[model samples]
Target chain A: MSEPTRGPKGRVEIKSEECKGCGTCVELCPQDVLLLGNDLNRMGYRAVTYKGDGCTGCGICFYACPEPGALSVYKIKDKALA
Target chain B: MARDTFTKAECLYDRYVRKTKVEPDQVSTHYCPGCGHGNVHKFVAETIDEMGLQDRTIFISPVGCSVFGYYYFHLSNVQAAHGRAPAVATALKRAHPNSIVISYQGDGDLAGIGGNEMLHAANRGEPVTMIFINNAIYGMTGGQMAPTTLLGMKTATTPAGRTARNEGGPIRVVELLSKLDGPVYLERVALTDAKQIYRARAAVRKAIQNQVENRGFSLVEILAPCPTGWKMDPVDARHWIEETMMQVFPLGVTCDRTKEIAPSEAKPVPFVHTDLRALLDIEDESEGFAPNRTHSEGVERGVRLKVAGFGGQGILLLGQGLAECGMGDGYEVSWLPSYGPEMRGGTAHCHVRISERPIGSPLVAESDVLIAMNRPSLERFLPDLVPGGTVLYDSSLIPDGVARSDVRAVAIPATQIANELGSPRTANMVMAGAFARATELFTVDHLKASLPRFVKAKATLAVNETAIDRGAAHMEKLLETVMT
Candidate 1:
């Protein structure tokens, strides 16, 4: 509905191999940005990459990442690009 | 709220036991000889009484030595599963948001089998408080080797002085759980001394206040003495807890969440009861999984992978980095850990399953891709490959170009590539880069967003950012060299 907040604060990073293909992230993303990736990664979790813009920095993504080290957020920086 | 002074300065027993004064009355505590559970309970009850929340609070008792907590605590409470007190607290925190729930668990209960749940609950920032007693031995279970047992300490299980080679090292639970973000308050105190007990009571008071003000998860781990198990006198027991356990689990607030997140300003967050029937789409048990967009919308490209390697191969993070890309792709997923004792010496293997379907188990039976980080793993798991699977092995590690028939094979000098790039650790990233080239697993754009998740918070912000780019390029060279 809105332009996705691409800032790293509230994003989810999927560790492709650790994914068990549970589709938990796809069903749970409130912003609906995470989806399974292509058949290219070593472990095909339909690894989650973004679809379009629409993420808030809310940590729902971080919570739902059951893979522990599989998914987590990074630092948010103030850049001129934004 | 100010600490209002009362005219009578009585002991904890009189003020909190449904009585007007502080002394032993109808409630007979079942603590062992020289056990610290009684003192810890006294401090907690007194704190509750002082706060005037005797009616508004709920107590949760653990299975170990503190099992008979209902005998003394004059409040609504239930005995929970061994090491599962955190789960009960989590449920209560979610259901009864306003109630102040306290979980009083022992070292055997909180730091052993229930270790993961405790860390996760703290990480979730549940509006609850926990009192973890670290006595170093399973007091209720006749002095077994608890997770917090001191190194080289003799126990029922570790008769030979708890060898580092056999039992491994003791887990520092407080320091480990502090890395998470959910806790509003965390402090580890020792009750072995008069000074420390007083300090512990104050910390407990602060933690309870945080809860009353609706602050999220507060944990206070106390190093209490067990004279009977340690085969020492009361004074000696306190001395042991102070000398041995304190060196490992230093007493202090791991995260002073009270300062960062004030509870007075806390409002009751909206609570949503999970609709399991609808979410599971369980019209009937016979139809196992509904194959529709409702449940199976994420992880379109289902890939189950197994990585095998040795300890020095830098292979553990291989599965993790790949899992990040999947998250970047907006896929539904889970990453399971596959580590065991064999990993300590020579061999290590991790099986990861990534898919669009609801995962029944974290264990991956067959793999779509197998990246053997070392020779031993290649020998161990070569036969377990699924049909039409792919193999990315280190050219230097593969013995006979094995599994070229059953699985599509590619050999890359991944570790060499990393050494050439000036970092041996990037070997795994280089392998990921090779997989990226051959598999088209995820676009570089998505992978770009996912790399930062593994960077440590204190620093590595800049090095990690630079490492990701370098990692991507090294594998890109492999793709270019191979394609030509």
Candidate 2:
């Protein structure tokens, strides 16, 4: 789980099982925070992953992602996770 | 403490249960990775959520890759035949004027096979939102050249390259539709990048909002990426749309009459005829004769009758009279007619079912009674008669009677009797009279009373009634001899 507790303005979660390694989200992410991981999901395709920090929560990646359930972008209201 | 705001749309199902047969994953769509359909689906779903149209929305999915759109969208879904989404959407919008109807179709489906349907539906100014995904190539059918395929574009069908002379130029659907006076809003957008996708999202919202306002037909043609079909990665496919596809299909609003046009009034409720007698122009005769509730002994299950003859022999009329008589007697009835091409000379047949209980199907594959007016009809339908069933034939026309001994064969010279009664067309009434008496399903008087409902000419009614009485008398005489 790549959770950003280091007080980033936002967080992005990538559901690995539903991702198909299309890299549309990775390429379109303005913060360059998303990447295709080496590990393969159950479907035998590399799934996208969050790079631990630096998510602006612009949600461009979410719109770019083709899979409806693969990406979730959240805007954190507070400085850090409680 | 931090509270996170979720950005995903709620209109999409949490789990796509309908897609279980295609793949094990419930969350994933059947579209290939980076397919433009997924992005468009997201936009539409989010718009539906934002507008609060989830409950009132009816989505018409076209044939092609997105045929399984019903599997993803949680709204009311209707899957149309290939290229027929516009037709379905028009009907849905007309029937449910308050509901938001959206027709989502692809390039090949909308512009190719269903071109005529889409054209006429839009021309009719039906207040329905249509999402036209123009990916340039037929993605679902394995990269075939679509009507919107750009010139010199290499596809499975156009392996070498698409040429203007050979395949003709790509169709700019939005531009073509802009020529029409019907559509209130028309825009062509792309899904090449975040900025273009945002434009597409806005266009989709506006198109749907136009329908919500009842401003008439609105279409958003989205230039979507087809990575798998284009043989490019997802990112490269997006770049290709921006760098190449936009040259052929420019992104812009071709028409915007939404602000000018007033919201259309709700369509009138489809006319229904509750008073069938008034609709059929028949006088109220039900009070004269009460419905006979007494059903025949063996016919408690139902009576399935098959009537067959030449088209001119009034075979269908005979069947209709039986069905109408059954209805008059308070029994559930169905009459289905099957006829060939020619109006008079071709073969004709009808299946009639009347029952004390509700009938399941109108088709009488194995009939309890076979009414044959010609020799061929008797020979063709003889095998389909149930064992110990009754066979009624026109003895004047069919000289060689039914060969089957398992069934009671009653030979009535129906045509000869009709000719004696002064008209040859009343032969069907004679057969109807025989049927009523032979089965004991209804009285001969009931059969005569129902004739005015079907018989149009008033002058021929007397002859038809006379033929029916004569046929019933002949059958009665035959039954008496058997009893003796």
Candidate 3:
């Protein structure tokens, strides 16, 4: 059984249902953090999967996705604030 | 459970599909994959949202790729005719003085076909913001040659590649518009990369801020990508804009006068009944003559008259006098003038409608009366005269007889009589007098009352007054002879 996991800086999360499987984000990722999955969504297109580590939260994938909500990078702030 | 971090764009609609669309399940736009319009639309929406102008904003979407702005913006939107966004935005801003209006246009829509409209609007300092997307080609029309097409760029229209010897050089719009004194802010920006996109977002916000602050005309020219039109991939198109288009259209704030120009505080024009009445100088019916009472003799319809002559022949003044006198007599009146481009010796005509009730249109398609001040005018307007209409022509100038047998015609030597009264310029006034006498629609006293109001010079007014009298006497003598 797989459990929810976190990466060092942040992880790239893809809305698998909304992805068009264009592979633009996979091709553009400098750290090789994303790849087109073998499985297809209900729309009959392959969804992108994260490589589970090495994401820098650069936001390049978010900008490159034609679909606005297809991808987002979430990071936890280091210092605690009031 | 990947922690619900990935989310939709803050500016985008909940669903990508327009609410008014018939296909409810559709959640996408008709724009090509990775089209720059989607990015630009997001920027505009974010600006409107951040500035709290969503409720008061009006987006004028022009023809071209940006015509569907209403489908996405989720604000008040109006679709303008091709290349007419600036003109439409100018009127919308003026009409709703408090609302923030934006003109969204593309290269072909703005610079190529709507150049004059954009130029005049900016020159006049219209208080509106404009978003110009320059993608170097006409994207909506299958990539036609645009005014901003690169020198060697090949488009649908320029199949052999744009050449300086034929297609001329691309236009630099931001720099060109910066020369104008009206615009308060002008900037050229790009969406090439994340850094450039951030800068473009600032420019977009500044442009909308200018309108919200009522500063004056503001424009942000955005160098956007058109991958499909450019025959390149989305990533390559972004690179092309940075590498190629940047060489032609440099990105920067071309002009910024926001600090110098103060915000406008003018109030919106009032459309209340009392205000309109005072503005138009419409007298109360009870305080003046009840003109429709005279038509108890059953003159059921309105009197539509067409007056035509050369530009300097007082044709418009003659029509104005009729409309003014009709208004004085408590009748609803309208006067519309048409003239040629030449200032003098140009063809001039006016339609005057005097109605007991409200006038439907100022245009007289089938005139009940035709006043031809010259031979050319008589021939020109003869076809528009209705059967049984009255034809009054200047006998001194027109040598031909009336051609229509069904109408009552009278040829008055109006110019000759005015010359005897010491001025040939009062011929139109003389004709006005003949109109009063022959039709008895308005009395000679009404004509006398309206004449003094229009003619400023004392001597000229006195001569015109005498000409009116003599002209009326001539028409009456003709009527008497016909009766005997």
Candidate 4:
């Protein structure tokens, strides 16, 4: 209800539940922005998410992630995934 | 399209993340050991990495030893059906014209069943880069005789040498496809040694760059080796590509439309118009359309014919022109160029299998009908005619020249009829007429309708109609006594 219009750069959302924790995307990430998530899911595989000030709005992670829609990278010149 | 974040700078293969110089962690290649496909994949990936197009490029991988290419390309890729990579590439290139679309396929994938897709895509000049691997056999299917199999090369089905009487010869794909006017750049390269591998990689980059610049259809057919399928060691495989494959599928550029493509004066890569239905359309008449053609049984529903004659005698057109007629008559039909180089002023032939059932095995060991435009073809193929099959030839060819006795042989004055029609080129149409009249292979009305599909000029179409009718009229009496 509080959300306003999102314009310009596209929104990228990470579907946390679908993550397979293959770590391929993590290893592939040239930015060193994604570290394995500290929170463990019921499946026991460590999930991956953006760390502090590390993500630099790179889309290569989107393609490198084989899991469909699990890891989406949004466009924000200022809001970094880190 | 919404803009997305990230580029190759974030990928694992980027120098910083690679840890070592080796990128794309060495996973066990899904391809068999020593297959050139692995090396080819490496070249493509390395080229894309060097070009910095990894995020923007899309790949279409065909079913073969290379089907698992998505694992290695480090880009968005969709695996395509066997022999269908060209078609898929055509579609993706049109829909996403800015993306660098590429198709990687084996010889059997590009030159056999997928041949139509390959030709149509190239003829239309799609801005897609194609990496054709000419390995001479259907590697994924366990070494079957592919359209690219060289004459005298043995395979699972052709354990004996592919002879003119049966398997014909290996198809020269680059040379054959180069004739299409729309292709802007065509090059046949190979990977026999270190220098050749370097050249092959450069060829890959060039083809990709051509697509990126919107020049036109660009293809680099790599004379790749299949050591497992060829029953050779890796070293010997390289030797074969140098010795045998190069003899037939010579390396270097065959046709390059790049002379006029100076990027300083060029437009962005143009989008290709590929009609899906047109690619798969079956010509047919409204009246004979069977609702349950799937299970219908009339006249046992089709015949397979092989026609052989010299290149200038209208040999190939005869089969294609008739196949068009049969297709118009609501019959399922496929016409394939006989496996071989198109002999210069020498023998040329085609295979036509018209059936309600789907066609299989373009190879013809026993044809329902054989039409020979000369004495040599008759002598060569007469022995393989099916029992009770019809063998028609030019009356000009005499009995001492023939080689078999089990089947029926009818000598029609095909050349005389064609010459009398005022066009020696009509000899091919004359044979088509004889075939149609003899077997009701398809109706003449339908055959005429199919004629214009092959010709863009209406005047030529009108002339061919006359020639075909004349051939049919000339052979009527003889056909009545010898055929159904």
Candidate 5:
């Protein structure tokens, strides 16, 4: 599995430094596109990471994540990547 | 190439620079992991941005885990005292009628300590939005049982588990507030799952929208999770809110009258000094009595006078009369009365300050002049007299006179003079006359002119006037004798 910054339709960016590894976004993500990474962030909690593909960019994960800047979801304007 | 559509909310500060402690990341909130406050804060920020209320919003942060709400939202913020968010919000909304005020409070703050404030603010139908986070426990103080704590919920204060008999059932705030006629919208939403959180965001938007439209008080009570306070994992806390807390606090709108009710038309009247005078029925300076020249001169450095006597001896009335006359003479004046419960016989004293400048304190701890109507009055307050201060005692009531030599003591038979004037009640006026002449603060004519303002009975006015003249004459004769 290669880590791609953006999928065909959308992108999800997780600021690892701000994540507390609560798994709220991972549990709430509809596309199963987020997971808690094995490496710990600066604050010593496992940080969330986006899967390489299949991100619908529903933005539910953004709302689910407690930290304000930890997660941001974006819908791609170009459809050709799909 | 992909272009971005959805992004972080604009209402939230880019970096929480206000979070003074820099150890934790400044880009993140101070709330614990999966804490409900963070989600609610995000929803509020998003709503503010959507509604374009960033410039007009004033957030009142309560004393709770979200006390640092000011640090996150890039809006005007005020941190209210514990449980006083509603009161603070009420004042803010009234003072700035054009602004949208939002009071953010927790269960312990809104329901427990500030319950009365919340209820009354709702009852008054103040045009403000309230976001209540009911975590069922005191999250900031460490899992103490709150008023919204569900039955059988074990907390630090409820180690035996909350019993209905001991702790009573949880308070349904939305239901209680729904019964009031003031609130235009009331809803309870939870932050348990994606669906519920979406509903909570909608409720938050609706509540604030109601305020923007001037629909009056709107409250959205969100059943939030406290993972650290509950001693549970973040996911389990969410499950507990869904399975347990939801059973006690059912989700949905408890009351909604947003359609039927009209937008608030009553605007707060801005405070004006002249308007206050008109409201109080006080005439303008041009139409009012002119200032007495002598009194203004005597009040250049201010005068602190203590009057003490038996209650029925008119100790308070004398002080009031002096204060009123001083006010009419264009001096800043204050009268503070202290008395026991008994109406007639109790010991009574009053402090009077007449000043050219504004009086700082009405308490005359040390007096420039002391008027003692009785022996105990003289003995009790004599020590507080400054050196070279004047003492005017009713010689008919206390024959011993003032014993101190350092202060000027003037003996006036005020009660006897009042009896000779045919009314014993006129003794206060006689003393007032002596005070005026002895201090040369004002003339007898000034007292007579102001007498009708305070002295109610029309029949006794003439006798009171005569009593004032006699007292002034007595003081004048004493001064003449001293000069000889």
Candidate 6:
């Protein structure tokens, strides 16, 4: 995965620190963009990580997260990348 | 993306109060894993914050796990009895029209115990929002069978899978609400998946928006997950809501008249005091009688008299006469009557309070004077008489058992006097006459003038007047003999 310093409006961010390893976002994400990482956070639960590069930022993952501030999406201006 | 890059929702409170007493440090939430209450709470709080309704919100939490809802939301929350959330919310909204009232209830509390309250509130088109969380079974009470429990579903109470023949059928709350004409918006949403969550959030927002616009009753039934009660994993619980619960309670907008129906003119009714002069049309007689210095100067408090007898003995009427006579003399008075189910032959009693100042309550537990017309009445009320209190009874009926050292228990031949007057019912008037002379509270003339309102028969009026005179004369002779 290409790591971007500044998340463009089209990208989505998952706060792996607060993720409960529920995998609800992974199963419900339409773009297949997220996956559970091998690493565990301070809460001792496996956190979700971004994988695919087609960043549409649909906000499905943001709404599905049970934990507060676990996911956030930024709308991208470029249509081609979405 | 990064770990710390996510932004918090603007509507969620910064911190939640710890609910459980044992875990004082557990500040996150009391909800079990996969429970939809946490999600719903976030959505509701966010909606209130977004709408700028934090100060105006009053949530009525029903008896369930969400009873601690006030601790979480940090708003003016009231805990209603089981199934009475809608009723409480209705009153709250009616009392304070500017406030936004929300009734949050669960399956068992709402559909099972509070079905009538919910139905009636919606039927009346009460301007309140309801967030109904239907998780199929009773989550708070270890998976008991709820009104919304699905067929063939196993719960703690229904160990052998729920049968339609035995457990009836699940209630479709959204469908039921949609059938009512008062509801402005009704929708059933679920928290099963991402797409479903989006729809649920929208539905909740719409329901609250309806209340804000004052558009009558709005209900949003949420198909929530209960993993512990369902005995399933969190993922499976979410899946079950989508697969099983949806089949029974379909996820959709059952009613939507937001645009068509205008906001109701349900303003709070201002209290208009009734003018006593116009309501009763009685002349102000307070200026006629001079205030008694003994009572008005606090040297004497007042008389708390209790009158007891058989129901047919006109005990209630005697007490009313005493109150009316005191009122006619420009004194504050109150009369309260009590009788059993068998109105005619049952035990009857009345409390009459007369004072220079306004009386507080009409219940006389410890009476200063007690007039008992029968043996049972004398036995029942003699102990409640205050020490040094005077008791008057009918010597003709109560032959004996007038033993008391502290109080003066006098017996008058009231029945014999009424028999002489050719009416058995005039016994109470005889007692009333003796009561007036013994207490020195009123004269026989004042007592007679108060009779027109209480006495119905004009023919018996002459006999009753003669009986009152005889009763007073008998008491006066007894007092003279005692003094000698």
Q: Which ranges of candidate 1 are over 4 A from the true structure?
A: A1-82, B1-27, B264-484
Residue B357 CA displacement from its true place in model 4, Å: 37
The lDDT-based order of candidates, best leading, equals 2, 5, 6, 3, 4, 1
Each model's Cα RMSD: 26.6, 4.0, 5.1, 15.7, 4.0, 5.2
Please report how far candidate 3 places residue B152 from its true position, in Å.
1.3
Candidate 6 on B1-484: residue-level lDDT in tens?
A: 1222234544454455554475443334556656788778877876887799888899888898888787677678899999999999988998999899989999999999999999999999898999999999899888999999999998998999889999899999989988888888899999987778978988888899889988889999999988889988778889988888898888899999899988665588676545654465444545334354345454654689999988899999999988888877767889999899876888999999988777788889999999999989999999999999989998888998477889998889999889887798899989888888887777887787677657878877888888788888899988999999
What is the per-residue lDDT of model 5 for residues B191-233, given as tens digits with 9 covering 90 to 100? 8788998999899999998988888899999999899999999
Instruction: For residue B133, give model 4's deviation from the true position in Å.
Output: 0.5
Instruction: State which docking tier applies to candidate 1.
Output: incorrect
Q: What is the TM-score of chain B in candidate 2?
A: 0.89
Docking quality of model 4: it rates as incorrect
**Quality class of the docking in candidate 6, CAPRI style:** acceptable
Flag the better candidate by DockQ, 4 or 6: 6
User: Among all windows of ten consecutive residues in candidate 6 chain B, which has the lowest summed lDDT?
Assistant: B1-10
Fnat by candidate, in order = 0.00, 0.70, 0.22, 0.13, 0.66, 0.26
Q: Which ten contiguous residues of candidate 3 chain B have the minimum total lDDT?
A: B1-10
Deviating ranges (above 4 Å) for candidate 4: A1-82, B1-26, B264-484
Candidate 1 lDDT tens digits, B347-431? 6667676565666776777778888977778877777788778888887656467655867877777767667656665667667
Candidate 2's C-alpha lDDT? 0.88
Best by DockQ: 5
Error of 2 at B403 (Å): 1.6
Where does candidate 1 chain B have its weakest 10-residue lDDT segment? B1-10
List the lowest-lDDT window of 10 residues for candidate 2 chain A: A1-10
Reference-based lDDT, each prediction: 0.68, 0.88, 0.82, 0.71, 0.87, 0.82
- Write the number of the candidate with greater TM-score, choosing between 2 and 3: 2
Candidate 2, CAPRI quality class derived from DockQ: medium
Global local distance difference test of model 3 = 0.82
DockQ of each: 0.01, 0.53, 0.27, 0.08, 0.58, 0.27
Give candidate 4's error at residue B147 in angstroms.
Answer: 0.8
Q: Candidate 4's residue-wise lDDT over B152-210, tens digit each?
A: 88889898867767977788877887898988888888767556766787788889888
Taking the tens digit of each residue's C-alpha lDDT, what string does model 2 give over B1-484? Answer: 1235535689887787864687645878889988999889999998899889999999989989999998899999999999999999988887888999999999999999999988998898888999999999999989999999999999999999999999999999999999998888999999978898889889999999898888889999999989999999988999999999999899999999999988665665677665776776655666534565665577365589999999998999889888987887788999999998888988999999988877899999999999999988899999999999999999999887889889989999999999887789888888888887788888898788878877878888888888888888888888998999
